[model samples]
Target: MIPAAVDAARAALADPAAVAARWRADHDGPVIAHLPYDVPAELILAAGALPVAVFPPGAEQAQAHLQGWICSPARRFLAAARQGELAWADGLVIPQICDTMRGLKGLWQFLQEPAFLESYNLPRISRASARPYFASELSRLRDRIQGFTGRTADDGRLRAAIALCNAVRERTALLFQRRVLGQISNLDYYTLVRASYVLPPEEMLALLGGMDVEDAAVSKPPAVPVVVSGQLMEPLAVAGLLDQCGLSVVGDDLVDGERAWRTVAEGGDPLAALAERTLNAPPCAVKNGPVTRETYLAALVAERGAQGVIFLHFRNCEMENLGYPGTRDHLERLGIPTLYLETQWGTAAAGAVVTRLEAFREMLEGC
Candidate 1:
């Protein structure tokens, strides 16, 4: 099954034409706009829309259009959208995850050629108010989805959507468990998991269902197992740098990685389930639970048997960066070595960043 899943996933990766063909055949109705992280899958499914994440293809010329002033992740998303890579989208739901994303939303709203555009205003990350804020935002989002689709978000419809989303979440959580138990390499897991965002959920599930879970092989245990925490959208290069430097990231608390699909809300009201699922997932910078960011990082490290922790922050991510000093100090008290890397999104080069990672890895090994 793992081999089959690998084969299916590879098919999607190998032939763009095939993937496009499958997408065209399988996807009916409007494609919900793609964002980097934390868009509720239930909303898209309830509205009968496809949730696609927008990302650049890592080509120099493709990135040239984003040169100067604009942050890398923003440029990459914009470049991809502008180049008609997102032509399939019938409408866009842009979540204001960060300042660059907020700016990108404005640019997209202004520039796109007559498509439905909705902006999602996320609640500020805090320990006390995040859940209520998210619940309210979800309510607003449900209304907007109903308005756009010309359908009402009745209780029955929402409950059915919640059940379907719970299934997807369960499947995703199983995959993460397999990875966490050392049944799969981080590279293979990352490839499969990252592709989930861009591909349709059914296709992703099909691929996952086919993966060889039993008798799965594992890579050599990393000398330094690290838990990556905080705001990370396009951290492909950063992960690669860590890998190159002999530090294996066994787990992550980022929306794009392990945290993206960890929990399911079972039984009870649909809205309540939705709220539970959102709050119970790994910590987000925008979370307002009683759990501090430091607690979240320490918990992940402990659960995953990580040797150290790396807090990767994007430049101008005011909330996350401001909270870093405290987070670092708390991790230190726990006897977990922590490293903070402040980077401009999209500007991280694997080779250059690997040097610092290597030193960090050595520190972990010595400890």
Candidate 2:
């Protein structure tokens, strides 16, 4: 059974805007909004502002703003702003990581002027020059954030924030290992991880620390250990299907999953640390800008002792489309079974997805 603390964390994730509203009321915070991917939240936290993720349930009335195969995440963020779900947000930080995100930033800037928005230029390649450029970007962002929040990003404060965040990741890593062993449900584990994006890390850390999970491994009737790679796992029914199939996600290369928590900021210089972690963290399909994800994914599969890999991509994501073929080939070459599927935030097409998972499981079992 998942602990009450974890249940509370899941509840907070379900209604993050409400939680942010409460935080603002209590802390006098200017909440900063960003997607679930890698953007330094420590900077915002160090600046005394709350960093909440812009994850609206669905993109209702957002089609008027976004068009031509725009991903649901972009549409949902716009819809949240237009529909007042993000009224608590004082600013939005859109990262330059994908086409959909870039379009979202352009549209958001054009539509809502006089709103403090920053189009963070996250690098495509982690080259020698990328570190300096990323550090400069972080400095500029820190300046704007200080000016907006009337707080200083002292080395002392930023380091404290980084320490807090790193501790949060360390605690989460424990839960993730338990999840792999089936000591915690995938739904519960993901709910806790997803909540970390929105909830105050200190508060989320306290909740995670309260989880009294047993150490015993609880395997289902039969299953294959699989690594799930994706930008974000949403609608969560996809994870539910994995649980149903008894396929344990031993590891992942998802932007929002292990990728975010596994790599924490390091160094005495907080800005440089954030930039370095951004560039050094798990390579994503878009962020790496090449075929690096294939090698990265293969390494994850082998390290996790996964029998297969499941590549989950948002429907209109170009980065994943470009990298999927090579990644599939790489795993196949290693004799690792794989499944690639396009998923949307709204529906799992439960029957279709579950049927596919069942068939995949059968294949892995035969192997």
Candidate 3:
């Protein structure tokens, strides 16, 4: 039986708009929409606003404002704002993850001009200076959120929010461990992780912790074990395709996957903790960190016992493109077969992707 918490999470991902609608019916304040990767959601919660994730799914509407080429996610999110899909969002926070996201922040402000908007600039490196810079950014963000919400986030409230978020992170990490042991299906695992983006940390923690955690080998041994890397699991269609194609995702480097949940905050200032956890989590395409991405990917591959790596990057994503050649070369030099899939938000070529994934599975099996 599916856990109730999982059910709630699934409901959130199924229709984030509906979740916001429900929050409106229940709560007394506006919702602060948070984009993916890194936005300190605790501050939003402390501001008396419901912090929700905004993942635009396509570029159809966004293309009108953008020229050249734009990544599917960045374009889609802007499209959501332009199309009134995110009209319920009282404010929006855009974290600086890459050039595409930076452009998105500008376009969102210039074109759509939401009532509340803040571009959170993030540091690309995890140097000693990054911590203070990030913490100050968080402080500034907190002030912006306060201005939007008209509520003060005292230290007590901020700490409370931090504790709640940390609990959710810890629970997600445990669920990830269970998934690594084959207790969870790649699709189920992906669904669970996607749920976290939309649901509040309190509810996510409940859902993640309430799982039965059976010994069901969703992906049996001898199935092709592979690690999937991407900006975010934009369309979970890939996980379903991988499952159908006989590929089991032993690990992932996606923003919503291992990157979001693997790290937890410890003692000290809440802002410092948030900054540290953000920097210490899995290596993102934009953030190289102290340890090289190749080293990080190698460790993940070894730890997960993966036979191959599948990099499913979205179309026109600059940061992912920057790191792709290096990742592919590193993995290939080590004799690990790597498949790079360039995807769009829509399913125009989904059948072709499935066929290619099936062939890749055959190759992994042969190896």
Say which candidate scores most in lDDT: 2
Model 2 worst lDDT window (10 residues): 211-220
Query: Candidate 2's residue-wise lDDT over 132-239, tens digit each?
Result: 888999999899888888999788889998998898888888888788777877777777788888888878877877554474557545557999988887766688
Error of 1 at 314 (Å): 2.7
| TM-score for each predicted model, relative to the true structure | 0.84, 0.94, 0.93
Weakest ten-residue segment in model 1 by summed lDDT: 58-67
lDDT (CA) per prediction: 0.67, 0.79, 0.78
The pairs that clash in candidate 3 are: none
After best superposition, candidate 3 residue 360: deviation in angstroms? 1.6
Better of 2 and 3 by lDDT: 2
RMSD of candidates 1 onward, in order: 3.4, 2.1, 2.1
Clashing pairs in 2: none
- Arranged by lDDT with the best first, the candidates are 2, 3, 1
Better of 1 and 2 by TM-score: 2
